[model samples]
Target: MRRSRCLLPAVGLLLITTACQGGSSEPPRATTPGPATGTARMAADSALRWSPAVVWSGDLNSCRQGEAAATRDCLTKAMQAGGASADAVTAAGQLSSAGELAYVTAWHEQDGIGVATVAYPFRANTNEGTRLIDAGGKRIDVDTVQLDDTLRADPGVQALLNAHPQATPFAPARAAGGTPLEGGGVRLVYRTPLRECHACADVGQLQIGYDFDATRHFVGQHVVPTPAP
Candidate 1:
C-alpha cells in the first residue's frame, strides 16, 4: 500500500505529552510513516485500508526544535527509535521544505496501509507542504526495505493466517526494538487483521516476525495472534 498526502490530516503544534514506542511493529496500529524522495512504488495488489496510530514513547524532545545538521541528526535518531523506515529516516534529513514546521505530532499515522507512519509533516507554518514516511512504511523498501512482495504473496503467510477467516488484506511493518539481535542478525515484524474490511475501528490482529541471518538470508518466521479484546 502507498501513503496518501490526503489521508494524513494536519497536526497542531503540540508537545507530544504521551510517550510512543521505540519503533516496533507490535500493536499493528502504532507504525510510523514519513516522506519519500519519490512516490511510493508498491505491488499491484496493494490498496488503501484503515489505519490508526499512537504516539511513540521514544524521547524526541531534543528533536522538537532545531534545523541544524546536528539537530536533524538527533531527529533522525528519534525517527529511527520511533520506528520510521530507514528510507524515511534518511529522507527526513534530506527533506528541505520551503517553510519551517512548528511541532512534530505525537500521534503519527500508519503509513501505506493501516499500520505505521514512516514519514509525515506536522502542520508547519502553512498548508503548502505535507508528505509520507515509512512504517510498514511499504514494500521491502521500509527501514531496510519494505516488506518484500514475494513474502506478502507467500502462500506460507496466508496459510499461517488461514485459521482466522476474517484477516484483512492490510499489512504493516514493525520495526525491531533498538536492541541488536544476538548473532548479528536482523528481525522484521509485520501485522494484519484477522477480519477483512476496508475500514473498521478494531478487528482481530496477528503478529508476524521474520528472522534473517547476518548475511541477510531469510531464516524463519513466527506468527502470533493478538488475543481478542
Candidate 2:
C-alpha cells in the first residue's frame, strides 16, 4: 500500500507475480489462538484476522539473490505476525526472480476452516517512465500537472491512474517475453530501477502486472475493503 518510495530503475527489468484480492483487515482481539473456521470465515473477517503484511523483499540477501528459503522464511514470519494459522502458514509458497517476487500464503476459517490463497508480487525497473502521451502521440516528460492531465484523459485508466498515479507508465518502461504460469493464467511483466528497496530514496521505473483472476484467487475479486476516512 505504501509506494511513495517504491521507485526502482529505468530499464532492463523482467516482470513477475498475490494473495487476497485486496489488502486484509486488522485482526480481531487475540483471545483464542486457533485456526479460523466455518462458512462465516469466507467473509474475510478483519475483526480478528490480520491483513497480509509485506515482510522484507527486494534487497540482495533479502530476496534479489533468488533465495527461496530466506524469502519463504521472511514471508512466513510476516504471515504469522498477521495471525495466520499453522496450517495456513504451511500452505505458503515462495516465487522470486531477478527483479520480481511472489509471496503466497493460504488462509482458513476458525475451525478446520476452508482455505484461500493470498499472493503479492513485487516488481522492479520498467521501460516506461512517468512521461505522458498526448492524443497526437507526442511523449512528455513526467511533471506533476502533465502526468495528472494525461491520466485524466483516459476514461478506462483514469480512476486507477488517479488513485495509483505513482504506478503510472514511466520512461524505460518496457519488458521482455512474458510467460504464463501453471494455471494458464494471465502473464505478468514488470520493470524497476537498479536498486530494489526504496526505504529513503526513490525507485524510478517500477512497473508490475498480473493475471485478472489472481486477485480473486487470493482475496476474492471484489472491491477490497477500506478503512473509515
Candidate 3:
C-alpha cells in the first residue's frame, strides 16, 4: 500500500493510544472455527473474503480539533459511511506526533476480513520553511528527514524477519497499542495454519513488534498473539 504523503509530517509524533491492548511475550489465542452449518458457515467465509476497497481516504482535518476523540468520531463516521457495522468500528490507537487516529473494523460478509485504518491530520507548521533568511539575509535551503522515512529504512524490520523465518508475512505494518516498550515501531502480524483442520476458516495470528528511535536506531523486539476477535 502506498503511504500517504500527508501523514509524513506526523512521523515524529508518538502514538497516544493503541488499538490492540494486552501486550505480552505470549501469543494471541487461536480463532475457534465456528460451526460448519447455516449462517455461521457463511459468516466465516465472508470474513475471509477481501474487500476491493476497505480503506478510509477522506480528509481528516477535523480530527485536529479534538485530538484523539475527534479522530475516533471521524473514523466511526467514515467506517459507517463505508458500510461498516456500527459495533464493529472502534478506536484502535492514536499518534502523538500528528494526533493520527487508528481504527479496526471487521466485516463477516466478506469472509471475516479485518480492516485497520490509520488517519493523520495535516500540520502546516511542521517541516516548513526550507529557506530561512539569516541576519545577513542570505537564502539557505534546509535539509530535513521525515521520521516516517527513517522508520521505514530502519534495519530492525529485517532483523525481526531474520529471527523468525517461519513467520507468515503481511504487508504494510499496522499501527497498534498496548506495548510497554518505548520508541516507535511497526506492527506485523502473521497467520499460522490450523493443525489437523485444513478446511477450517479460522486461524491464529502472530504479532511481531519492532521498536525504533527517531534516528531509526533499533530499540527492541517483542512477539505476541493478536487478541481474539
TM-score per candidate, chains pooled: 0.27, 0.19, 0.21
lDDT, model 3, position 61: 47
Question: What local distance difference test score does each model get?
Answer: 0.36, 0.33, 0.31
Worst 10 residues of 3 by lDDT: 6-15
- lDDT tens digits, residue span 189-224, model 2: 334332223333333333333233222222111111
Give the candidates in order of TM-score, highest first. Answer: 1, 3, 2
Give the winner by lDDT: 1
Give the per-residue Cα lDDT of candidate 1 at 99.
41
In the range 128-160, model 3's lDDT, one tens digit per residue, is 112211222222212221123323343432233
Error of 3 at 181 (Å): 35
> Model 1's lDDT to the true fold?
0.36
Question: What is the model-wide C-alpha lDDT for candidate 2?
Answer: 0.33
Task: Name the regions of candidate 2 deviating beyond 4 angstroms.
Answer: 1-70, 94-101, 104-118, 125-229
2 or 3, which is superior by TM-score? 3
Q: lDDT, candidate 2, residue 139?
A: 24
